[model samples]
Every structure is written in structure tokens, then in C-alpha cells.
Target: MQLLQKFKLGKSKKSPSKGHANYAYTTARVRAMKSKILPKETYPRLMNMSIDEITRFIGESEYKEDIDELARIHDGVDLIEHALNRNLAVTFTKLLSISEGDVNFLVGEKLKKYDIWNIKTLLRGKYCNASTEEILEAIVAAGRLSYSFLSSLAAKGTYEEVISELANTEYYPILKGYDGTNLSDIENQLDKMYYAGLFGTIRESKSKDRKLFAEFIRMGIDLKNLVTLFRLKKSGIADPEMMNLMIDGGLRLKHRDIEKMMPLSFADFVSELESNPYWDVMADVVRPDMVSLIDIETRLKKHRLKSAASFSHVYPISIVPIMDYMLSKQNEISNLRIIVRGKAANLDDDIIKEQLVI
Candidate 1:
């Protein structure tokens, strides 16, 4: 993957915090954020907490502002979910504010997932007849799409109006022809479009520093593809039906590979994730119990976050650290939501703990 010799852009591609990039400064900030991230050791202590205790605990963490802002109107899991999403949005928005050049481009590319997320939120909200306020809370304004645009789209009365709102964007072309009633179909198109755009951006880049960034996307796509593949297989879905859900362009897992594997069984893929038979290095974090799908998904995500942090070190000056920090912060928000929701539902501590990626 070393393209330094093959492609030279005649610019200081390795610029850190000094001169061209604020890399040194950004890395320092990212390191500090990483350090302040909820310690893995603290998850056990958190699992023992009740709803009120968990809310209080969250108030004391980095999410205090988000909590205070939303606590006045929302309560319990709702309060926590909105607050967590807000804080996650703020965190990623801050990443973009502080970054520039390749770092900015790479982070922006990765954050496009939120763009897709916001679109899905719009679709689901419209389908369920949810309020604009509710959908607004779910929108993370970290991607190129402005908060104003999303807010406007969220306020639209119908999904057709929403799609019309996005007529000028990349999502327009794919979403325009879809039957608006089938949210599942639209969501699949959005996912494929998002990944296709991301892969295209990285592949088009001539910078060597961006190589690892591409690798990161490949890893993510691979994980997502596997998770979706297994879910479909376990449900006894026919091979012919998975084409839309299956994402293309993975590191080792391709569309053709998926086509060949789907008609067989899920056991082989389960074992791969369970024991890391193929990718031995990822075994430690993604050791799924095979009983619970949540466990498998959690394992995959936890490993993905862990690997992001580790890989950041390998290219500290590049986009790695900033992007890694973004994922870690996102994981923090997800963990908090899981805890809040689990506790509010009166689920046991151990059950809540099982869902924690920390």
C-alpha cells in the first residue's frame, strides 16, 4: 500500500502540526480526547448503575453540556439518547473545525456515513410520522450537508419533498428513481451510494498519506458486509434477494465472494468472526459468542474502534489520529445510549454490560 514512491504530489504530504498542517496541534487535541474517553475499566462500574445514577454519571462526563441542555425538556432514555447524539455531532463537528487539507478530506469522507444516517433518519421519521424535532435530534451535521439543509428536509411533509430537497446532492441521482414508500429500498440505495462515493474519493486521491485512510474504509466496508451477510443468511434469506443489501468494494470480501457464500450457510462466516480463522489478528476484540447477534455486532464494532486507535499511532501525523478519535468518540456516544436505554428498560446490569463495547 506504500504509494510514496509511485505518487508524489509535489506538496508536503507528511506535514504534521507545523508549517502546512495543524497536525501536531490536532494530534495533541485528539490524544487528549482519547485520554478523556470513558475508560474501559469504568464500564463495569457503570453497568451497576440505575437510570438516575447513569444519568448523573453521564452529567459528570464530557457530555455534561449536552445533558444540561436537553435535561430541561427530556427525561430518562430520551434525554440520554438526544444528548448523546448531540454530543456526538458536536464532537465530530469540532474535528472538522480543527482539521485542514488531507486530514479534512479524510475526516469528511468518513463522516459521510452520518450523511447517509441523516437521510435514513429522514425516511424513517417520515414513514413513522415522527415530528421534525425528533428527526432533527438524530441529524449529525458533521458532513458536507448543512444543518439548515437537513432541518429543512426534516421539516418537509413527505419523503418526495425530502428527496426533492436533496435534488442537487449526490444522493439525488440514486434516490430520485426509488419508490418512496419502500424505506428499506431507499436506505439500501443510500448505503451503496455512500460507500461508492467514499471508495471513489479515496481511490482518486494521489496522496500516499491517504492510502491508510483508504485501508480504513476497506476494513469498515468488510465488517459491514459481513454483518449484513450473516444477518440475511441466518434469516434463511435466498441468495437472489441479498444483492441490494450487500455492499461492494471490500478489502478481501467482494460482491462475487458474497454471491458464492450466501447460498451455503452462516456457520463458516460465524466461525470466521468467532475465531478469526481468516483474519487471525482481529480475533482478540471480535470474538463473538455466536449465540447473540448483538454480541457479534458489538464485537465487530469494538474491534473496529480499537483498531482505529492502534492504526492512528502508525501514522500519527496523517489523518489517522483525527479519524480514529472520531470513531472513539462515536463509540462513547453509542455506549452511553445503550446503557441509558438498557437501564431505562429495567434490564439487568449483566445484560446491559454485555451490550457495552468498552
Candidate 2:
């Protein structure tokens, strides 16, 4: 209790100014953490393992503590899923704790997605009358909001109470718009808010590494916009108003350029994308006749992770390496989940491999 109180007191406060970031220490710690990520060869090995074998495999790795802690209540795939989320939460929270000043602030900003994710989870869970335990299991408390607070929100008797509980947070205004319906709208709005906030933070920083980080973010926005464009085109929605789904501030693809492509047929859209810089990332998987956007999305994600890994070495004692480690760690967790869940679902090994970034 005392330690928790101390953490809330010291870690809760945002750094007052730019201040000195403990980048050397933070990046060193991040380097050691990155070394623990599952090797590329591990995924192929995991694919051939049965669920039990897979569970044992992770249980013996860095996830051992999480697996042991959650073993009593959850078993099989459920146990692995919960342990993965818990480990992710603990790992990211450790980053926040170990970092100071600007590093802490930037890390927190990047992680706000978890907080947003928790809020959305709580609301969605309440909307569908899911039990608190079920809602809590879906949560990854790797953000600014503490799990205790999110858990309390999850336990709220009604959505109104949940919204009221979050009335003091930055998301309150948007939360107030949730009228038991429009969950998707609210979710989109919250997502937009997150990217806007992150972009705004980056724009305010003039540091060289931060500028590079901003480029990384812009690249993500471009990919997200491309995904949205593909989905809209696949759904046959040629309406220009769909542009509202497009985010601003992309590194290469501009808002005007996306607007121009909104009315094009899927074939034309693919043709148009060929001239764009991102085309190279997914050209092998992209085609107008493709039935699924899955391949394109996977390729794009892999490219982004690979790009971050490449950049991590360029600037060692800056936010770049830390960000790279975070992305790599996230990819590791995602890949493991894909293999374990895929095996449990009896998905074909080839199909599972298609989804894996490694």
C-alpha cells in the first residue's frame, strides 16, 4: 500500500518541462529488454507445437511469472492470453517507472493507447452486459490509467456510471457523447484524439530524434489511412465524405492525394497506390482482385517494424531505440498470441504463418 501510494505520488505527475531525459540509462535498459524478445526462429517452432506444448514453452520463458500467477484461474489458451496481457502491462509500466523527464512523458504519450483501449473496453463490456472479470481480462493496462481505476470503471453498474467516473479525464468530453449507442463512433473519435494528441506532442518538440520520431508517426498515419481507404473501397463506398476517416499529417501521402483516390474503383485505387512510396512495402501482396486486405495489412505492419528496427541503431541514446524496443516487444507479443491462438483454433499452420510478422 505504501509503495503504491508512493508510485501514484511520484510517477503520476507529468514532467513540468522538457527537462533532461535519462536517455542513456533508459535506452540501455531498453536494449537489455529487447534482447529477451522471442527470436525469429521461435515462431516456426511454436507453429508445430500443440497448445499444451506452446503453453509450456512460454511458461518456461520470460512469461513464466505471468503464467504461474494466472495459472490457477485460467488454463489452456485463456491462461496464455491473460498472461500475455499481464506481461505486456507490467513491461510497459516498468518502462514508465524507469524513465524520467521527457522520456517518461513521451513513453506515456505513446502508451496512452492502452488507457484509451481500457476505456473503450470498459464501455463496450458494459454495453454488452459482460461481467467485470471478463472485461478486466481484455484489458492491457500499459498506459497512464492504472488497472485499479480501469477495473473500478469496469465494475460500474451502468455505462452512465462509467462515464461519470471518467468525467475528470481528457476523454470525458467524448465519453459524454456515448448514449449507449454510437460505440463505433465514439471509438473512432477516441482513436482520432489519440493520434491528434501524439502528433501535437511531436510537433512541439524540435529535437532531432523527436523529429525522426515524428516521421515514424507520420508513416503510421499514412498506413492507417491506406488501410481505411482499402476497406472503404472494398465495401464499395466511393463517397468522398469518407475522407473524414482520413487523418492529417502523413509523411508521404497527403490529405489531398487521398481525397483524389476516394472516388476511384478498387482497381484504380491499386493503380494509384503504385505511384505512392508505400506501394513498395506491400506491392507483392497488393492486387485489385485480392479478396482480403489481410496480406496488405500484414506486409505494411512488418515494414513499419523493420523500419523502426533499422532506425533504432541510427540514434542509440534517444527516444528512437526506446520506441523501437516498444514496437518490437509489441510485435513479439502479437506474434506469440497469433501462434498460440491459431493453434488452439485449429487454424492451418500456413494460415497462421501468413498472419505472423516474423
Candidate 3:
């Protein structure tokens, strides 16, 4: 708890002049939680367990409270998934609570991205006509939006009503143009708007910590854009406007480059990548007909994690370390979830191995 207390991201309103001291307490706490993240050996054991066994095992771990709370309402993969979301929400909220200074402010600001995610989830759920409970299950509590607000949005019975509710929020204005469209168009609008907001925030941050944070997010956006571009090209979408949906900042690729590459084959795309800075890390994943979106995403995540970890070492006193820990923890959680699912599906070890991030 000492480490957790020290690593808080909040700043005291009473002491406006104190700089990094605001993060002292929160940073310490974050460090302690970082220490508690699953060890490398834990995954091997988890990989051998069924979903139920994995749930029970997590009940004995840091997720004990969430598992206990969710077990009555869910079982199997549903239970595990809900418990994971609950734990994530609780952990991120705890992080928010412990923060006090500028660090707190910045973290809170970043967490708003989760609000954007929640809105997208609500819109998608509404379009699909999912039940209220099903929609509620998708809400990740890791963002700045209140649970009450999210619950209200999730409970909305129609897409129109959901959009009306969101109209009061920041994303409403951005989504206005997409009203009365198919779900795909709405989803694309959400994606573009979210990244646009993220880049806007990055542009405004002035601190070293903020710069690192911006870069981390930008890298993720760039990877996503790259993947989307590749996918659309494979689908034979030659129109540049269609490709523009995948545009994101932080990449050296220009609009012209994306347009010119629209008609190229996947092999040509791989060749283009081979000539770029990302070549070394993405070389193995490059190929014609490479449609493994999950694998490409996993590779991108690993690259981001490695970059964040390296940056943290270089800027230990800044927010980089805390952000690094957050990203690492997320990867750990995702990896464990994959392992659990693989075991439950009874996939062969080699196949599972191919899916794993570690």
C-alpha cells in the first residue's frame, strides 16, 4: 500500500506551487500495485486451467473481491469477463482517487478516453438491439465518465435515444454528421472522432510526462490506422476517401501515401513496411493475405509496451513509469484472458502459443 500511496496521480489543490511532490504519494502506491501484477510463471499455470478453474484461481489472487461480487450473477467466461471489467474499473478508480496534483489532473484527463469508448459501446449495443444487461457488461469502468451516466446510456432503448443522450457530451458534436446511418458508418465515425480527440489532447499537453503519454497514444493510433488501411486495401476498397477513415497522427505516412497504396497487393504493402522503420519488428507478420488482425494487434501492443518500458527507464521520475506500468498490466490481463480462453477451448499448445503475447 505504501507504494500504491506514493504513486497516486493527484495534486493537492491547496498547494498550487508544489510540482512533482503531488505525485509522490500516488507514485509509491502505483509501484506497489505494479509489484503485485502476475509473474511470468503464473501464466503457465493459468494456461492449463479451465475457465472455472481460472475464475477460482483469480478469486484467490488480487481479483478476489471482484470475483466474489460477480460470481452470483455470472459463471464461466461471462463471469471471468465481468470480473475482469469490474477489477479494471476498481483499480483505475483507485488510481484516480489516490492522485492529487497535476499528475492527477493529467491522468484524469487521459481517462476520459474511456468515456469515449463507453459512448461507442453504447451506440454499437443500441444498433445491435442488445439487451440492457448485455450492454452493461461491455462498459469498462476505467474511464472518467460516471457509472450512472454510462448506465443511463446503456439503458436507452433506441439508437436515436442513445445519440440524443450523448449529444450533451463532448462526442455528440463530432457524431452529429453520422446521424441516420448504418452501424458501420456510425462505428467508423466513432473511431475517427475518438482518435481525433486523442490527438487533440496530445497536442495540448506541455509537460514531459504528457509528451510521453501523447507519444504512447499516438503510436497506438498509428498502428490501428496501419491495420485498417491494410484491411481496406485487401477488401478492394480503392477509394481514397474510404482509406481516409484510417488516417491517424504520429505516423510518417501521408495521405498521398495511403492513397497510392490503396490498389497495391498485400505483398506490396509488406514490401512498403519492410522499407519503413517498423520493418524489423513487423517483418515476421508481413505477408500476402495476412488477415490475422489479432496477431497484428498483439504485435503492435508488444511494440508499444517495449517502447514505453524503455522510455520509462529514461524518464523515471516522470509519468512514463506509471503509464508503462498501466500498459504492462493491461497486457498481462489480456494475455491471461487469452490463456484462459485457449485452455477452455482446448486448443493445442502450438496454436495457443501462436496466439499468446509472451
Best by lDDT: 2
lDDT of 1 by residue, 1-358 (tens): 2345325534544432122455688788888888989888877787887877888898998889989999999997888887787878788878878877556766777788888888888888888899999889778776777789899999999988998888888888877876757778778778777788777777765566668778888888888887887688677675677676777777777777777767765565556444333355445433333555776677778778878888987888777887787788878777877877887788887888878888
Query: Candidate 3 at 3: error in angstroms?
Result: 26
Clashing pairs in 2: none
Q: Each model's C-alpha lDDT?
A: 0.76, 0.88, 0.72
> Estimated TM-score per prediction?
0.86, 0.93, 0.84
TM-score leaderboard ranking = 2, 1, 3
Error of 3 at 34 (Å): 1.6
By summed lDDT, the worst window of 10 consecutive residues in model 2 runs over 11-20
lDDT of 2 at 57: 95
Please report, as a residue range, the 10-residue window in candidate 3 with the lowest summed lDDT: 12-21
lDDT (Cα, 0-100) at 294 in candidate 3:
64
Give a tens-digit lDDT track for model 3, residues 57-174: 9999999998899889888887887788788888887877887766676676667767777877887787678998888888997877878888987877787787787776777766
Model 1 TM-score is 0.86
